[model samples]
Target: MKGKISLDLTEGSWTASGGLTFTKASDGRTLRFTGAHGDLAQRSMLVDATVGDEATLPVDLSTYELDMTKITVTMPSVNSPGSVEGRPFSTTLKPDGAAVFSRAFGTSPVPTGSSLATLAGRVDVVPGLG
Candidate 1:
């Protein structure tokens, strides 16, 4: 089955829009993600750089397995101008139904200063009919 996954960053004004294609398997299910594409806008603090525009980042889908509550995905190292780019990152999804999604990035000091860092909000999953 094919579907779209959308995420919203709760701490700030960043949102992620992406697509996922799932295939049924003997063990469980396999999910492939297109990418995490979205926009970022800073509304609280003033910065020395531009704060709003289109952003596209690759998500690692090789290690994902369908689960009851949680699924982990990676964000490859990015080097885009005027955007938050760094070494490869990963986030986990704990979805309640197909509308709300909550996620966190990495396993260290915690994500700070970017929407991709910490995310929590609604995700609209639209399934495609076969």
Candidate 2:
């Protein structure tokens, strides 16, 4: 992500701009992404999320306005061919948090790709999890 972020939204809130690419390990499908980041920040005490067309959407919420929500996105998925075709994803970050996503909303603190794979041997495709 590349953009200016102001801690105070009275000054500014957040910014998202980057072309992200990743490969799905299960099927070895490489995916590339680029899109406008729709972000919003409003003064709120309560947080809410929803799921499916009913969808259990991926979300990141380690902290919200000085509180630990512990709700972070774990998996960004697609199983069959074009599973996500014409699908849309949305996310929310409440007060006092930073989200580094444009078209990608993965919240795994574990940095991915080859460098990570090198650090932890064969970590890309976990045994049982696969």
Q: Which pairs clash in the backbone of model 1?
A: none
Q: Which residues of candidate 2, in runs, are more than 4 Å off? A: 1-7, 10-14, 36-130
Q: How many clashing pairs in candidate 2? A: 3
On residues 5-47, what C-alpha lDDT tens digit does candidate 2 reach at each position?
2222222233334444455456444333333232325322121
lDDT of 1 by residue, 8-36 (tens): 22222323345543344443333334434
Poorest stretch of ten by lDDT in candidate 1: 97-106
Q: What TM-score do all the candidates reach, one by one?
A: 0.23, 0.23
Reference-based lDDT, residue 111, model 2 = 33
Model 2 RMSD in Å is 19.7
State the lDDT at 54 in candidate 1: 18
For residue 129, give model 2's deviation from the true position in Å: 53
